[model samples]
Target: MSGSRNPRTAVVTGASTGIGEEYARKLAERGYALVLVARRAEAIERLAAELSERHGIDARTLPADLTDDADLAQVEERLSADGTGDDAPIDLLINNAGRGEGGTFTKMDPDTIDAMLSLNVRAVLRLARAVLPAQIARREAGEHGAPLGVINVASVAGELTVNPHGSVYGGSKKFVTLWSESVALEVAKHGVHVTVVLPGYVRTDMTRDVQDKGLPDFAWIPKERIVRDSLRAWAGGRTKVVPGAQYKAADNLLRVIPRSVFKSVARRFG
Candidate 1:
């Protein structure tokens, strides 16, 4: 994470827990060196050690908040090289560092909204931009045309009509989903693959709290299955993979329904 590693390295943000942790583990299983990043240094370092012991792969823990410009620059610098040298290109980048905040828009704290948007949207795109030039360069060199996969973890809320309490969170994820799709098309011919993973209520510490507060059953999904399905989709070159059958069905429905009617149904269901 701090220092550069092999060109086959995979950088996974928010790698301390949830789906990000699963992605790190699975990628290690597939023999990729990892740059595991998260706010908590100890947790990510422990995970790195565990992964190294189990898979014999290199795992570096970079403890930095993605919202910080300095921290983001550290990552960007490690992934970039001068025009004279092409040494450390990130083969896979997983932009999985984001959060969800719920409440009425007017009642929400302005600072919280700003921070959420900064981390969820700004950091996601900036990180992608920092690494893309190197990826494109590698593709142009015809170096195996080895796959460069970028997985953006969006949300089921991105595909649904706005929920009163989840409006801002939903809007941010919708940005991720749309931006990923457009960028995937831009990079596909260059041998770079991009996927936006729209997960539906994955069971993490975050969802546990939401459920404890009595959110509806339709809103909770198992995290393991989400990870499994997403890893499969990422490996198979899928541009967008929505986890869970219910979420898939719901997405398909939202596709055809009128926005006004969909909004009404979503409010009642949520």
Candidate 2:
């Protein structure tokens, strides 16, 4: 167990693959009984089974397309119920399910952009909204530890809305990053911690094509590193995490650049 008072139940979205799967595995090792959510039932089930076998933790797989309001409602319902004993609470919630569609702004279809933002931004915001109150309540009652936390997996693309073919994707992640920071401030008095994981590029299937597309050296980061760094950052209740060193420096640079210069620089990546 991470700590005597730490949460035992952790709910992770997008557990079918990549960072989400890694979060599920590591959380189980730390003694969390996981509720794994993903659109693909078989993948989440297999992952849940493997985690259970390896860690001796209870893991439930829920196939949920968060883009669907109905599916998100089911997750909210599960979180509201303390399936565990009253003393144990839903310790952690990892909102990691997101997708992207790439093209020039003019070339991007409206429906595709809507779907991307819906999954990447709206769904995450809604899920966080659904769970935060319970977490705050548990904290106020002195039932959870230092920070009953939520980690929203944003991207470094949010830091500099500059990537070619990533206008909508970048905007969506920026929205996630901004909202998470605001929520962190709003909920700290209640002891509910919120962290944003802003990764650059990782070796997930989602970025396989980006690798082939001749990514800059800064954007090249391995998935294992992302997983390790994110776990460490979330545990620390960091407001934001930039996994890659190069990307971290780039993120720092974006903070000081003038808007006009930044917009022009953004066009290069686009």
Off by over 4 Å in 2: 1-7, 82-88, 216-218, 266-270
Measured against the true structure, the TM-scores of the candidates, in listed sequence, are: 0.89, 0.91
Per residue, candidate 2 scores C-alpha lDDT tens digits across 1-270 of 223353378889999999899889878878888999999999999999999999889899889888788998998777665435452456678999999777787888888888898899888888888778877766665564445778999988777656643788888898999999999999878777888988877778787777798867756777667767877876777778888788888888888988988777666654
Clashing pairs in 2: 164-269, 164-270
- The list of candidate 1 runs beyond 4 A from truth reads 1-7, 81-87, 213-219, 263-270
Residue 190 CA displacement from its true place in model 2, Å: 1.2
Displacement of the residue 137 alpha carbon in candidate 1, Å: 0.6
Model 1, 2-75: lDDT tens digits are 22234367899999998889889888988888889999999999999999999998898889898889998887
On the 0 to 100 scale, the lDDT of residue 25 in model 2 is 80
Clashes of 1: 0
Position 114, candidate 2: lDDT: 83
Q: Candidate 1 versus the native: TM-score?
A: 0.89
